[model samples]
Target: MNIIACIKQVPDTNEVRIDQKTGTLIREGVPSIINPDDKNALEEALRLKDKYEDAKVTVLTMGPPQAEVALKEALAMGADEAILLSDRAFAGADTWATSTTLAGAIKRLGNFDIIFCGRQAIDGDTAQVGPQIAERLDLPQITYVEDLEIDGNTAIAHRAVEDGHYIVKTEMPVVLTAIGELNEPRYPSIKGIYEAFREKEIKVWSLDDIIVDTSQIGLKGSPTQVKRSFTPATKSAGEMLEGSTQDKVRDLIVRLKERQII
Candidate 1:
């Protein structure tokens, strides 16, 4: 069995900055790390690789050159191979454009038993890329997967829902968006880090290699456009009522009544 895991690098919350003019994130010179949810997905893929005798896990990521750091981290964790999709044309991509680019990269990878990705990217916060890739590839997709077992050509999985979880059965080559409930990610050991640092055969693909039309990629292909963004307004001054419990309760009730909340 062969498993493909999609990973992404996102801005560290503390260092995040939005471009005021574009309303998009400013990724340059910012602290970046792998998306937290994708770590769970990586753990799940590594577990499957361990269980299967001949299975191989491949980690792929789409972003600028900076994103190669995230793929290297995946390699240090235990992925058999790593692929980085980087190009100037891939900037400012929305979910749909991103899925298209990733699917194209997957096509280049050829055969695969299963595809795994995190539930969503923290930066975008829209859980659409996985399902969108499934649609583009005409493959089955299971989102919010908490657990999975591969049996021959079938995959038996547990998916999370609004109220509870549901067991699902799907064929091989299915795409799964893993939830954080899957498993905990492991830290890279000394030996693993050494191996990752020494490994010389990393696959890097550019837009030209993938034959992505210039017009159909990057900002041009993205349907969603951001107008502008600004810092939120500051809080206004407010009164603080501190007194006896009875007096405070009465005042609160009167305020609620005045606001027609009661």
Candidate 2:
């Protein structure tokens, strides 16, 4: 089985700050980490590889050169290979363009039986790329998958839904978006880390390496535009009412009425 796990290097939200004047993220000093959910996806892929003797897990990402760090981390977690899709033409791509680029890269990587991805990246939280990639590839996709198993060429996935979870079965050559509850990600071992940095060569691909239409990549291809972005105003502390129970209740009601929250 050839499994491809798509990952992303995202800003550590804990250290991210907004530029008040520019209404943009202050990324200059922020550290990047693998998208938390993507780690779960990678873990699932690694587990599948462990279970299937012939399985090969390849971790792929599209970002700046620094994203190589994310791919290396995957290798250290026991992925068989890593691929970096980097190019100036891929800059400022929205979900649509990003998925398009990824789909092209997957095509160039040859036949893949399964593609895994996180439900969403923490920074964007849009949860669109995985489904969009499936659309581009014209493959079946299962999102919010908390558990998955394979038999023969069929994939059985337990997908999370609002009410509960439901099982979905799809054939080979499918995309799955994993939720964090799927599995606990394994930490990199000493030997694995050493091999990642010293023995493995992460394959890098530029725009020219993959088949893509010039009009469907990067900022020029994105249809959605951010008109403005700003941090929400800090909320004020709530008032504390002091009185008899009945008196306090009455006062709260009056306040609610006054604020039109009744």
Candidate 3:
């Protein structure tokens, strides 16, 4: 089984900051980490590899050179291979263009039985890339997958919905977006980390390396445009009630009624 796990290097939420001038994230100085949800997806892939002796997990990412860090982390966690899709032409791509680029790269990589990705990237929070990639590849996709098992060429997935989760069975060559409930991610072991750095030389692919239409990638290809961006105003502090327990209860109810919160 050939499994591909798509991952991203995102700004650490706690240290994230926006550039007031560019209306974009200030990534140069801030710390970066693997998207939290992508870790869960990688964990699921590792579990599948463990179950199937022939399964090979390959991690892929598209970003600046620093994104190599993320691929290395995946390798250290048990991925058999890592690929980096990097190029100036891929800059400023929206979800549509991004997925298109990824789909092209996957085609060049050869046959794949399963593709895994996070439900959404923390930075974008759009949750569109995974489904869009499936669309581009003409493959069925299962989103918000909490659990998954493969038998023969079929995949049984538990998909999360508003009410509850429901099981869905799909054929091989499918895309799956994993949720946090799937499984706990494993840390890099001493041996794994050593092998990741010593034995692996992550393959980097540029725009020319993959089959892509120059008119269908990067900022020029993106239909969505940002007119302006700014942080929301800080919320006002809440009022504090003071008195005996009974008095405080009465005051709370009065405030709630006054604010129409009840």
Best by TM-score: 3
Error of 1 at 184 (Å): 1.1
lDDT score for residue 117 of model 2: 95
TM-scores of all predicted structures:
0.88, 0.91, 0.95
Task: Flag the better candidate by lDDT, 2 or 3.
Answer: 2
Task: For residue 15, give model 1's deviation from the true position in Å.
Answer: 2.7
Q: Alpha carbon lDDT of residue 224, candidate 1?
A: 85
Off by over 4 Å in 3: 239-244, 254-262
Write the candidate numbers in order of decreasing lDDT: 2, 3, 1
Model-by-model lDDT, in order?
A: 0.87, 0.94, 0.93
What local lDDT score does residue 233 receive in model 2, on the 0 to 100 scale? 86
Model 2 Cα lDDT, one tens digit per residue, 211-236: 98878989998887876777678899
- Candidate 3 structure quality by residue, lDDT tens digits, 1-262: 9999999999997887788988988877888999999999999999999999999999989999999999999999999999999999999999989998999999998789999999999988999999998998999999999989888999999999999999999999999999999999999999999999999889999998999888889999999888776767889998889999999999999999999999
Candidate 2, residue 219: Cα displacement in angstroms equals 0.8
Task: Give the worst 10-residue stretch by lDDT in candidate 3.
Answer: 224-233
Over 4 Å off in model 2, which ranges?
A: 238-262
Q: Count the backbone clashes (under 3 Å) in each candidate.
A: 0, 0, 0
**Candidates ranked by TM-score, best first?**
3, 2, 1
